[model samples]
Target chain A: MEFEVDEELLDIFVTEASDSLEQWEAISLNLKKNYSADDLNKLFKIAHSLKGTSKSMGFTQLGDFIHKVEDLIAWVIRQDREITASESQFLLTTHGIMKKWLTGLQLNGNTPDVSEVLWTIGEYLKGEIENLDQLNTSNNMQASEAHAATETSQRTGIEFLKVRSDRLDSLIQIIGELSIHQSIITHSLNNNDVQSNNFKLAVHQAAKMTKEIQNESLALRMTEVRGLFQRLERTANDVAESLQKFIEVTITGADQELDRSVVEAIQDPLVHIVRNLVDHGIENEEIRVAEGKSARGQIQFVAIADAGGILLKLCDDGKGLDSEKILEKARQKGLIKDGTELSENEIHKLIFLPEFSTSEQVTEISGRGIGMQVVKDTIAQIGGTINIVSKKGEGSEFHINLPASLNMIDAVVMELQGNKYSIPLQELVEIVDLNNSKLEDTEESHPLLNWRGSLVPLHYLSNELILNQDYAVQREEGSLPQAAMIIKSNDNLLGFGVDRIVGHQRIIVKSINGEHENNDTLKGATILGDGKPSLILSLSDLSDRLKSNHRMEAV
Target chain B: MSEAILQTSEQLENDKYLVFRVGTSYYGISLSEIVEVTEKLDTVPTPNTPDHVIGVVNLRGEVITVVDTRHLLGQEKSESHLNFVIVVNTDKGKVAALVDQMIDVRQINKEIIEESTSSIQSEANSHLLGIAKAEDRLIYILRFKDFIQEALSRLNGER
Candidate 1:
């Protein structure tokens, strides 16, 4: 008899198995604190369900292994005492094996050979009999703590339709096309001066509909960060155990949702940061006791939906970043000038510089200074910024502000030498008439503009960006550089001398992946209402480039 | 499989190409690679871009980089506007190639194309696959990827 796995049933089993494994992890961590019959029942239900599903699906080998674990779970439930540490350990081991088999099945069509795992689990089940007397009688509480979580999950009956990501991508592309056409229609209508109110109203409604559809399609790609945080909790525990330290991980705002792509992109950096927290951030129990702090150090992972983006913070109450040590290392590594004076923020940022690890001892964890630089690069790649703050004995917090979405932005359109350009709206402080604003020139220093009583360095659009050295200075009669944009990034402000303001619009940004992708002055290009590609300017990138003024002339 | 694709590309008359004029020279870009062709539109010149870059223009909803074919062909800068854009789909995305004039699409016999360019002295036309004869004119078949590769190398080498 051939045992052939039904494709549909295997899919169901895989989904159910993964979900059950996730729940198993959560409840197992809870069970570690106090013995809960409800949690045990939930876990038992999952094991029994998998055993039944796998047997029915004809994966007899997988079914048989789970059936053994199910028997052990039944025995544990039948016991009159609180679960012993030895029994609990075995229970966790059973769950681990089940998770591995299910994951292996997902990656490959066939179930893994679990004979060795089955033998090991059988040994633990056999050993569980001798552990019955190990439980203290006082620890067993026999009353029903309502299985509230299971009740809620059953009542909610959350229904989700799995969608191929490519379909959503196609939907977005169509919406992008719709927006472009809508813009062209509106542009033509306005140009031709259509007097019909009904036609104008319809056009506005269509534009609004396109924007809504774009947002909804974007929302489809978002997933809550709860799963990410839960997994990191286990990672923290493992790192702490290896380091022989006691560390508690507290994660908040786990329900906050980010684009799945953004989450995937940031997960590695987050993992490294958490690993650093457990390895380098948290001090050992003995050292902590000497410092008059709790022996168990705490690491907090918090994500907050901020004004324009998500603020992810990883703070640890352990040994803070040694700023002096970092600066010294930077000097030793020739990363800094001999007598460079830096603010505390700049000093803290030195750790992110290449080959600037302050730690005297290198470890498998993070001492090569590779992790922090990776953290910096990953965050920057997503147009996010990271800032570090620390107190010597207290702790350190890494604040990461990631944009709410990656491919879309509200942009202000402007013109430089008759070409349209889009600048992120968040970066533009205000737009002023260049004629109304007073301007002054300097030879050695940057040009100055007296913008509303404050002096700002002003740069001509074509000259600053070097788009064309030969743009006809011969303008029509009295137009003295039509407009100037007050672009800002943090505390630095620069006035961009432009020819005209093209108003504001929300645009879907398509990334320039090849050829000009490495261009520092531009972020990506977007289609305008008139159906032309306008380059989106990165304010931070522009500010950095402007301050340096070293690379602009490189070409 | 490669031979089958080549056979289909041959399809009795060989591959279809979108031929255009750069000065007196005629160049052929594979028809399969072209997305759209348009009369010259207003282009916003990107600052500090390579000299051959015509500018970035709005094509439907795509912001495609426009490259001047005449500049790459090393012909004398024409006094008249290179007012035609042939948007080609490259591996990177859609980029518009500027031409002084556009000719008609024609299937070039693969056997007629001269693969070796030793006799052709123009470095600008170094990436030309070969010259193919059709009717009364000789059309230069271009290797699109090779042209972009050479352009990038030249840009990098310029610095």
Candidate 2:
């Protein structure tokens, strides 16, 4: 009888198999250092489930292959053996082959040839491959080749994410409704002129609960960074092995929680950074010894929740980023003019520029001239910033700050001609009271305000925003703006004048659909505490607009 | 019997349109395109948007852009308050249109609807699918997808 594979069932099996394989790989990597019975049982369970599911889904070859792996794991568990380095390496190689087969299955419902892997496992089961040295000589070359193929194919396939439960989604929805209802209650109370202290206290307490629920619901989307750090550790090890270098990698804050989407988006850039550290950033043994440093290079990855975002610091104790070499490269590439004096920090930043590579010879690892620029762009795409700090002959540290959640941000609510608008608090350097500052009207169309002994261009919020005629008329008759929000845009200070600073609050940002999406002045829209929709201002875009307007005026 | 069956199948294809007034003109959008008809919600004016987009409004928890139908149809901006917002599902998302009044939904026959002629085809009226003759009034059936795409293109042009 010919067997027919159910596409839907096969897809489920594939997703389940991929997840199990990831768990197996992570556990095997961990078992290299610390071997525990519980972890071994987890491997066994994962392998058994994968085997059963693959068989049921008509992937018998894959099932039989995993069955052999399961037996190998069972043997280790039965012997109560401490996983030596060689055994752990063997498990990891098995994982690599399984992952490649899974990717092939996902791309096109076919698994690859697994006879070689099965033969190696057969030898191990038959006691021919007993020790570390023999397994290494037999499998290392094939394993590295398989790893390369898996990496490329995995990049081309669709990434499967862990499915979130419907209950979490409903909870978030209910929290949204609760917040809206709370605002309605507040609005009604204010409108009815209820001045009773007890009633006010009750409403205030309800509001507080609503805010807490909103925060907790948002937290449901967060996941720990441990998985991401493990992948990075794997990448570091692989790069170090390929380079034939000895390195020590230290990681902290593995339990730091970030939005799942943020974690997924950051994985590639972090991996690239890790590879660069292992490849170009760290020096080899001879150079390190000659520099009076330890022979083994050290790389540290630290993550901490700072302010309202995650701060990731990747530091490498190696021949630090040589600004002179970077400057020379920048000059050779005509990226900078001759005799242009740049500070050491500025010179180090030149590496992030596109097509900037200081490597004398291009290696397979990094110097094809596309790594750092893409890293910077990816980080910036996720509302994050990356900065480099290096001291000559000391080390280089990359500081990346990313928002805790993409949709929620702390914004300072302000009024422009009775219409409420919000500016992300992170963008504002300081809020200056225009009433206290001196305004100078120059030949320029916009006014300049004196801020901290320097003249900063001041833009009236009403004039800059595309307001209706009524607001424009009101602005013409109203008094001068009372506040100026000083923002640093492109390293220059610009002040935006508004009617008044209402207050600061955490707001859930919702994208404005249709025509307004393309409006650069508005980042997005958010519902305020009063259940009113307010526009969130994009300060950087606004600055760029103002700058262009000035240029046009000059023309 | 065959003629009767043919008539019934054609009638099945006929759709009910929700008619609304902008200035003196009445426009009909198929019911499938509409999400809800709501009372005019408060809109916060967005800067740098096209003139037809009055602003965005908070509908339930979602913020939807509100387009002024009068301006979109090349009529003078409404002086009085728009009493109704017809929220429609567009390719972009849910967008609400400000109208002077909400007329009754009517099931218009496909046979009586006249395809828009090239003589009436201008940039403003390009989104009109056809004109339906119902009782004593002519309702311009709006191709909502095209209407939204045109509005978005106009916004892009302004930018």
Candidate 3:
């Protein structure tokens, strides 16, 4: 038969193969307990399907291996042979091999060699049953005819369609443009005196329809966080095995709903945190026994929906961080004072500082001072905050708070140098209006505004101007002239001075691409409902400006 | 001595390098690898991105990061009036390096190229693939991808 390379075949092959592999993994896990005739039949049918799919896809070697696996499973079933430890291992290994080949097929349009793979599996199968008499002897006294009673269950589910990301993004962009067009039509009808009621009614319907279309298209890109959370369980298994520590990773709130973008952005940081738990948090079995604790460690991920956001917590029940060692390292690196008085959380937060390390030895995985900063930056970029909490002996917990979606963002709009900008509301502790205050540029060079009790570092938006023009004063005098936006992130509270306050509006963010003369300081541009382009201010860049000013003053 | 042709050897003539100026410095890129030079590129400004990356631009539809050659060549700034973005394909990936202006294509003898040797020299020297001397003027052949890496390292080193 001629092989067809179409989307439907690809989808069916991958889905069926993945399902079979997952079933095989689950069955292998139960090999030591018992093996039912039903399980054997299921395994045989999976192998049969794999053989058919692989042959049709022109993966001859893979097809041959599946055929061998089918025969082996059938032989075990008919002979009433009990599964040996080695036989279970062989089954699991075959499942892993199939997954690897599937991934290869996904990347390149063909499967690689599997001749040696089948030989290895065949050898492993032989170790379990040296002869046909050995297999029949281990049977649970059930007659050979009993195997004929069991049959394979049929598979049924809502299928998944893999759409390329660009196609989805393009569909979203067109929907965005459609919304803009609807807005333009509404404004034209309201302004121009075309007394035709039909025009007004038509524009109103267009506005409603466009809004629904935009929302639906955006929703199509979203996926549940449970799938990602489930994968983390497998990652924990691998990490614990490699570290030679018995760590059980349990996930709570896997069913919590989150946007696909939020999940994608959080994946790396979550992986890094889990790796840290396995590498550093969990003590060795010997150490655990000495500490009078259970030899097996426990790592848990708890996710819940907070007000307007999701709160994710990763916790480990093992040796907590050494605050004293962290402080010593911080002092040695000159990141903190020698005798700095800090809270337990503050001391733990010090670990996230750049170049801060308590580990004396470097490993291939982490502790190179790269992961934490990346984690912090990634969280900040996604309008999220990660708070660390720990006790000396008790394990650490990282609380990651993130917004629901980047596309649908809630921001506090403020004006700087007569230009309007929006800061994500997640970063704002509270908006404090500073009027007739003691905000001054200090002789020490860094501007500071004494707010209530604390000395809040002040950054003026006008100071960022290259030409140093006072657009704030140049604008008409009747409008609100100056204000400071109090924002908090990474435990640092600061105030940004601006000219006016524009009420928050839901904006569709359109990334400005190519090259820009002043792109460094600007984060991204948002297309307001009215079609005006507003530049988003980079808070980190603003902090850098403050740092540079401080350095200039010192010199 | 015979008058040497400005073009390189018979094997190298077809391999044209499109030369451009970022401020006062001149740099060349292979013509065959050039994607496209676009204007008013709506680049997503990345915060804390190295000085070389002016921003990321959308070419046709792909979001390609654009680097500033003025910053790559160790210059402070360039005229925003003549913002010319030149997209080049490097071994690492496709990067759109923004320049101030486009200069004419110049051929050089590939055999006469000298590899840069200075370590304690200007920051730009580290990114320069080699220097091609043509008559009175010299052109710095920069591996733009390597230029990005070297520039990022210098930025990190300064920090």
C-alpha DockQ of every model: 0.39, 0.54, 0.09
Fraction of native contacts in model 1? 0.40
Q: After superposition, how far is residue A282 of candidate 3 from its true place, in Å?
A: 2.9
> Which pairs of residues collide in candidate 1?
A466-B47, A466-B48, A467-B47, A532-B58, A533-B58
lDDT of 3 by residue, B43-137 (tens): 44344444555444546544455666666566766546337877665544566777877777766556666887766227666566687776666
Report lDDT (Cα) of residue A198, candidate 1.
48
Task: Estimate every model's Cα lDDT from 0 to 1.
Answer: 0.71, 0.78, 0.64
Give the C-alpha miss distance for residue A59 in model 3, angstroms: 0.8
**What lDDT tens digits, residue by residue, belong to model 3 across residues A1-555?**
225567567656766777677666556544523666777677888789879878877767778888987877776787787865445445655665666666555445544455655565476456643533322222211211111111001112235544447657766776766666566666766788446565666566667767766666666666656656654554454456445568666778877767777877777677778778777888888888898878789888898999787898989877788988988888877898766699877888888787665667766445644568789878877668888887766788889998776676666676654445666665566666667667667775347888888888776655554421311225454553367777764457877777777877665555554333243455565655433345566665576666687789879
Q: Name the runs in model 1 displaced over 4 angstroms.
A: A1-21, A29-35, A47-75, A78-116, A128-201, A338-340, A367-369, A428-436, A451-455, A468-493, A550-555, B1-10, B78-80, B117-126, B149-159
Error of 2 at B5 (Å): 9.1
DockQ of 2: 0.54
Q: For each candidate, give the interface RMSD after superposing the true interface residues on Cα.
A: 2.9, 1.9, 8.1
lDDT winner, 2 or 3 = 2
Best by lDDT: 2
TM-score to native of every candidate shown: 0.79, 0.83, 0.65
Off by more than 4 A, model 3: A1-45, A67-95, A106-117, A128-202, A284-295, A328-337, A354-370, A434-455, A465-481, A515-521, A548-555, B1-159
Q: Rank order by DockQ, top first? A: 2, 1, 3
Better of 1 and 3 by TM-score: 1
